[model samples]
Target: MQSTYTEGLNPEQKKAVLHHDGPLLILAGAGSGKTRVLTHRIAHLVEEKGVAPWQILAITFTNKAAKEMRDRLERMVGARVHDMWVSTFHASCVRMLRSHIEKLGMGYHSNFVIFDSADQQTVVKSCVKELRLSDANFPPRGVLSVISNAKNEMLTSDRFQSLNAADYRLSKIADIYTRYQRILVQSNALDFDDILMLTVQLFEKHPDVLTSYQDKFRYILVDEYQDTNNVQYLLVSQLAKRYRNICVVGDDDQSIYKFRGADIRNILDFEKDFKDAVVIKLEENYRSTQHILEAANQVIKNNRGRKGKTLFTQKTSENKVTLLAAGDEHEEARMVAEHILWLKSTTDYAFKDFTILYRTNAQSRVFEDVFLRQAVPYRIYGGLRFYERKEIKDIMAYLRLV
Candidate 1:
């Protein structure tokens, strides 16, 4: 078949685009054309492989990324691409579960709401209030965190009891988890964990349903594949056990979501999971200067147990990294603000060009306060994501109804 993606890409990228055999893992470095490769791969699947749009599943990490991929696919194949599965992990799972909720004893056209951290805390607070637990002794947030952990690991109340240690707090949290799931089910709701776990259960019990979906989807592509949790891994594994035509793209060095139950083992054991997996490294970076890529590569080299590869950029510009030491916290903020102000005033740099990154979202508060005091135009990124927005939730609820 003739190729549609070879028009703009160079020879190396064209090679990656054309190679469509077995389970492919594109180990893309930062600032690499990972999105370009993914979109081109989808286009190649349709145009070259003759795969229908409904037979493709493109899983992304964030709603923004999913939206971008959907937009790109739409541009590639126009309106026909809208029928394909392209969304975040949670969003896609929710859609899948909602379609076959009856197999898992869940009601169809039900209100299966997904609660974020704050929403879960609210539920926990209500549970604590009903249980008459002391807030001083047992914080709702702490209880919710424990419950969330258990759910992320796909542990049921019975399983939790079997493995429950002698810790009174853990026991109490398990009891709360059982109660929480019961409440969620009664309210016709399912949190993020329930989405995948329920779908897996449905697939296991209902053979015909599973076969129908398995026959429908011919190719599955997952982005940020290293960040898949246990439930997500299980869901993908079950779906691909029949066809085994799955392609996962990710960088092992950039797997930074362990705290939220993301198992890096998924990436490490890709060969064991999928026999004779084809590993392709896209080491040619398109973003950033050569010097910046060197610094990033050096910093990431400190991380051990990674699929080793050196990233190089074709751009020859030299961008040097700057280090500053300040005596106090306030002084550090003041220094950064002054530096940004100086850059904005002297150079053609705009206020939007500069960003302050920190380890935790809490660290952004001091900089935000300092920037406000200095009357600088800056935006702090934190809190609920775009998919967690009220409008998006409402729209999803409506779609779930339909």
Candidate 2:
């Protein structure tokens, strides 16, 4: 509704901006103005369409994106944007559950905790010892993945036993899952899956609370819809029933998380779920060149069962996505080192501006040694993030108690 705001945007982006309606799906390609459209739509709704800022739910994939979107929308519509329900799916679900966790016998300020994959692995290792499962037979890592998969599919221990009792291995995995869940519940903690699963349970069981939120948040927007698993999809389904102003934006080609229980079925069944839905394809490439676009198109063309869109690019040339093979890791390191030296000396590339990724953490040791030899300053962003670990905090607390 902000006429002047749409004046600067191109026709496609303008259409997206004006489309402030029911169950919109914006299929954004890489480097497309998806963020721009998202921001403008939010701004337009708040600024001109008289949609109260609190009623709009703008979700993103990452906390960083959520922050950026909130900041950008705040810039457009002033401090009122603070009232908007803008967060990642995990964050949003946690907040929703926090408000009503007591209904499930959790404390009001229960201080529910989350364990990272590594922490969960630690729990699994302890369980392996307790159960006396031989390392030769049951690897902790493999069992952990099995349990994670079961949780992702929203399978409770009883449900899994009833359904998958024929498989002995599956029974063992469910045994581990049941124990892991018990430890979590006993500790008054909730992991990422608990956030989604519990929210679904709360909504299904507590109709009054669901109705309150449904009436409170008039519009719900979900980003990265394809990544949603059973629990996440169920959460969306419950909310969408009442509000019906739900917009899900995602790319099927970008769905790379099948291993972790992300059901591409949610995207496939979008039309079936939402009877009256608007599907919009954003195919204009604003970042990549024609060559890159063509190569991507050719690769994705091999995939089956997709409502494909033709990606066209008016953009000019850029550096190519090089494909290379190395006989050994040493050869790979030497090639990488040479490239780094050339980039720093010949080209105007900074070490800070560049990133080098390897398949495994072990692979990074060679790169680190090579970079150190070349006197290239670099740091790997992994492992324990500050302020969260129990060992680190407990040490500090002991020192304080001393």
Candidate 3:
């Protein structure tokens, strides 16, 4: 019998969705309908495999992605989607900590406040001042970043101190980390990194709590597996250790969050970590032309230590790949602006059809200047999003405090 969720999936995608047991790695290429397969698999587990909706957990990197997955599953299998657990790592940890954190006896309560980046900086600055440290020598932001990295690596302050005891600067940073954590506990607060760190600690300290969750989530699926940090990998590993029914979907080439402590090895070493794991590759391209896929495949092939897959598409296009080089940012921006104008004038393209991408937000200044001079209308997608604005965050902080 054909299920509604499996209607349009290709053979590889169907195989991924119907794989009922064991650890599975889906090397989903770009535009390979990974989200569709993920949602359909969850739907299949409930409707076809006789698994209860509440027994499934689907984790992603962003709350936005979690919401989109939930919405899709809701449409596919109705209101029972509410019974399933679908959330980002941080969010999932937050939920678990709220219920079981007090049991750890770490002086943290269920009502502990979650400190945002700005709040974290404020607390770190206070710790620096209280510790009689020079702000110029030990900047609060840099210190906070080091502490965040330590937490991502699942290192306690004592462990970090012992590991870097020879380095004077690192020793002082460890002191700051210790004091910063003290202040957080005194204020009944937890920083963003603490969410995952504490959960791992909780699981390690309390086997019963870990067992409860490990038994609850019979089937676990992690999206963007390549972007998972050490702490996140630990969290998922602990939960899925018993059942071993974990499915991870990601492209090693898309692992771009290294700066944020994302470990590409998490995906690359999946097969080594899980014995007899089913490996599936989804390399069909649905969003790009043949030329674009070929070009991208060639470029990514040069990347060492990646699971190999070639992306191909049935769709052909007359357009070919174009490479542009400029001596400087000004020239590059000017060239892009001129190309956009030419395309608009010669072809049926509009200013809205032209998009410019840069490595960093700071790099957009030159392009914006060139576009303004050329009278081209453009909009920047990212720049202090509404919730991230100072005033809005301040208001939210006040509400959280209250």
User: How many backbone clashes does every candidate have?
Assistant: 0, 0, 0
lDDT of 2 by residue, 1-402 (tens): 456458767777777777776777777777677887888888887787889999887777789999988888888888998899899888988888767888976443446777787777777777777777766567877987776666666777778777778988777777777787777777777767777777887888899988988888888888888888787888888887886888887788788888788888898789888878888788888887988998899889898987687787887777776766888887788788888878899888888878887666667766766777778777777743233357768887999999
In candidate 2, which residue pairs get closer than 3 Å at backbone N, Cα or C atoms, i.e. clash? none
Candidates' C-alpha lDDT: 0.80, 0.79, 0.92
* lDDT, candidate 3, 273-370, per-residue tens: 99789999999989999999999999999999889999998889999999999999999989888998899999998888877777888787678778
Estimate candidate 1's RMSD in Å: 7.8
- 102 Cα displacement, candidate 2 (Å): 2.3
lDDT of 3 at 353: 84
* CA deviation > 4 Å runs, candidate 1: 106-119, 341-346, 350-352, 368-377, 381-402
TM-score of decoy 3: 0.94
**Per-prediction TM-score, please?**
0.87, 0.82, 0.94
Highest lDDT against the true fold, candidate:
3
The true-versus-predicted C-alpha distance at residue 213 of model 3, in Å, is 0.5
Question: What 10-residue stretch in candidate 3 is worst by lDDT?
Answer: 380-389
Q: Which candidate has the highest TM-score of all?
A: 3
Rank the models by TM-score, top first. Answer: 3, 1, 2
